[model samples]
Target chain A: MATVVAVIASTHHPFYYRASTSTGPDRPPFADEWVRKITAFRETLTRARPDVLVMVGSDHFHQLWLDNMPQFLVGKAPFYDANWYNEEREFGLPRMKLRGQEDLSAHVLRAGLDAGFDLAFSNELRIDHSITCPIITLRPDADLPVVPVYTNIFAPPLPQPKRFVQLGQAIRQIVESWPSDLRVAIVGTGHLSLELGGPRQFGPHGPDPEFDRRAVEWIANGDLDGCLAEVTLDSLHAPGNATHGFMDFMLMMGVAGAGAKADYVDSLDLFHTMEAYFTWYPNGVPEVGA
Target chain B: MSRYLVDKFLYTVDRDPELVERYREDPRGTVAWWESERANDLLNCHSGEASTWLRFADDERDALSTHDYVRLFELGAHPFLTLTLFIAMFERDYEEPLGFQKQYAERLSGFTLPYPDIAT
Candidate 1:
């Protein structure tokens, strides 16, 4: 049986991939504390050296918009991608190419069906910052095999927070039942609280602060009920709709379930969003020297 | 020039609600004074046809926020989060065969928030 070595969640916010323009050689675009948190998270991934990865994230109305959005989609292709933007393209972040997990993806897809999920399967799935940034930041190796699970929370009638948690559980069972000695990692990437183009629109007053504080606590303690109460569509996006980004965390919390242990926890209050990161050992924390 | 308005307009709205208010107050006056080649190109983006800037110029953000503008002009709000108005409004047929953004998603995924580290 395979071992679920680690469960992690993080912000796939694009600024994370850009190297800072700050002349202050040491100062990165994010706060020093944020930089440290990310580095710490990376260190954890390094130690785990996962052989297969599962990423749960949503598209930003960019690709997966109102046109033909899927509620829950799984990627079975052998690869995926993200286009580098203007200056980043010029400066050369280069369009990234990431490997996919075929055998494992097939198993998870089947499990979802057997579990009564009317899931969508895609062999031609292209990903975005939500899937790319974490790989670049934490896993550096562009060829790391991964399973991409796309969610729908950006628009109305989002899947309940409870459902995401349930998907996490289903994923764990499938991974554990696999016949390889694989070390697996599950990463849920996106925001905690954010708003854009809505009433609170921008700055000085955005991303309901109180909710952010409580929600992070709930996640750290694995409190699903607390999260469900706070994750209503209205609160997620009153002034701006970006609050949907939090869906990733909800799914992640579910995947971590009751037995997961918190190895590290931190949050960075960026201008438009409250960025957060957490690492968990599903069964128990890994040994230091191992 | 067309790209500049979309990019700059988005940046301004995200950081300067004040500018948003001003645009709301005098849409024509505000956009007119801003010198640019494609400053009026947004009006042409009405479902991929050339309408009149005057149509949207008077209502400030009202005309601009219309479904047409959101869906056709700026593509979507993801552009507001970055300076790459080009990505939001423009594209190249390169990333083919590898999960390339359906249409508007490439712009959304690549936008870099105007981090404080870079100049806001």
Candidate 2:
């Protein structure tokens, strides 16, 4: 029997990617202070060494379009590019293999449907930056096997918070029923606040410190209802708050189960970007185990 | 305002009059209905306040009021519904807007509907 060992949710602002490539020594989003925090977070995930990494994030119209959009889409590729968005220039594309677990993708799909979720299954899905950028932080060598799940939060008629949480529960059930004995890690990427392609894009693309602190606290405490309440769909979809991805966090919680505890590693308020990162463990040693 | 007018409109749209009246008094309920019934297509429609309405679970309905319904109507609900229903009615009522007489012939475009298996 496989268990979900860890659950993580973090911000995926393009500025973070741009900061990683900057030549300047400024320590704003990618400063030494922030780098150390994110590196430490990644270290915690790597230490877990889950057999499969289930990534829940939003698609910025990378693979599908409005003419034909799936409410919930799953990546069905054997392997996908880890730096699909970084290829805008002369950057080399890095492909991450799934460690021979393509069957798990189909299993998850079937289980999701059994659990009453209408998921969009794609056998030939393309990689996007949201999935790739976080992969760079977690697996620098890009060798980790991943199962990417796409949400329609970026588009309209977004899944309700309850439905999103149910999706996570479905993922947990699916992974638990797998015949193979494996450990799985669940990662949710996006922001607590900070919307893209809007007037909020002035300088630093971060979120409000108070709200971020509250959210981080709730997640660390494993208070699913509290966290869900704190993040209203309207508040998350507000002018500057891109908290729609919090639903992903809720799903991660479902996968981690009720006993999971999270540790806040990094909290970055870079310009208009609110990049908060956390690492959750199922039954590990409690540090700040709220 | 009058029940007769409301009933007439409901009959025209083939919607339940009581449901329409309920929506007039509680737009959030209407939003919930839309989400539960047409979630697949509704998810793709871009309405700024759709998330707000969808987030309201059954438990939270007690907090909603008639003012919210009025606000919903003011916030382009009528236009949205009218446009959507117009499309439906047009497809239902008319054989063809442009007469299907002598056809403007052209080469067959090789486009095909997406295969259901490959597309989830």
Candidate 3:
């Protein structure tokens, strides 16, 4: 059986690509601190040394549109082209190509279905920044094969918050059941109190700093009951319009398992949104060679 | 009100560099042309299989044609789509980073919570 080496979750701020790379006059004042924090977060994945990554992220009206939106979809292609034209135009993100782990994708689809997920499968998926931002921060080399799982947090009438958690839990079980000898890491990205295209956008801090504080506590401590008790479809809007994306973090909480505190947890309160990073080593932390 | 169609306009225009420019330079003309030529065109389907019943309401058309993002917000157009497309077209005009975005936010500051339903 494949070993579940690590469970990781983060906030995918698209501007990080430009923020970290920009020089001198163009660079944001917070770039150095952001890079330092991301460097420490990157080491968490490095220590786990996983061979394959199961990436969970939400599509932002890119390939998936209102015409044919799926609540939860898995990419089953042999390769995935990362980033989009709009992402390039807006974020200055470089185009990237990532190899896929087809066998695992097949396993996930089959097992995920049997587990009652009704998961949608896409053979050709052009992933956006939700998955790519983590790749840039956690695995800059982008060498490991990945299985992209996209959830619908952007479109209306989305799946319940608990549904996302259930899917994450199922993914953990399904990955552990795989026949491969390779070590696998489940990494997902989400938001913490975000607002886009609304009155509260571009604030000095996330629209609701109080919510961000509580959210970070919930994820870091794996407090599913406390988190779910407060978060609902309608209730999410108060934090910020885009706060529903936090469900992705709830999904990661499911992968980390209830009451299982994260081994490493960190957060940075940036303008617009609160950036967070969490990692858990399911099979105990790995020892690094000198 | 065809919120979906309004979103489709934003989505289609934002993705195409030429359309973004055209929409920026000539909002009324672009909106008029798009309604006739591209509004009914099923995004993922062949042009021959276009939908016949997809057209924007008069108010929606005016909002989009005038680039009235505030009106679009009140009409419940998807905020993310509205923000992204508007940024693409107008962000370049601002001198400072995120200047347009902050101004955009300030313009919508009157809106309270329980924002216009974005459901389609």
Best DockQ among the predictions, by candidate number: 3
Model 1 C-alpha lDDT per residue in residues A92-133, reported as the tens digit of each score: 344777889998889888988998877898887778777877
Off by over 4 Å in 2: A24-30, A82-100, A203-207, A239-241, A285-290, B1-120
How do the residues B1-120 of candidate 3 rate in per-residue lDDT, one tens digit apiece?
A: 899999999999999999999999999999999999999888876668788898889999999999999999999999999999999999999998899999999999999999999999
Q: Residues A1-290, candidate 2, lDDT per residue (tens digit)?
A: 77777777777654454455456544243466666767887877777777788788777554555446687888877876544422342123344444324777888888888778878887766666677667767766666677889887654557777777778778877877877787887788766655332223233444355666776676666677777766666666443424566676676666655545675456766655567787777657334332
Best by lDDT: 3
The per-prediction CA RMSD against the true structure, in angstroms, equals 11.0, 17.1, 0.8
- Put the candidates in DockQ order, highest first: 3, 1, 2
**How many angstroms is residue A261 displaced in model 3 relative to the true structure, after the best TM-score fit?**
0.3
Candidate 3 interface RMSD after superposing interface residues? 0.5
Q: Pick by TM-score: which candidate is best?
A: 3
How would you encode candidate 3's per-residue C-alpha lDDT over A19-108 as one tens digit per residue?
999999999999999999999999999998889999999999999998898999999998999999999999999999999999999999
Q: Name the docking class for model 3.
A: high
Task: Output DockQ, candidate 1.
Answer: 0.05
DockQ, each predicted model: 0.05, 0.02, 0.93
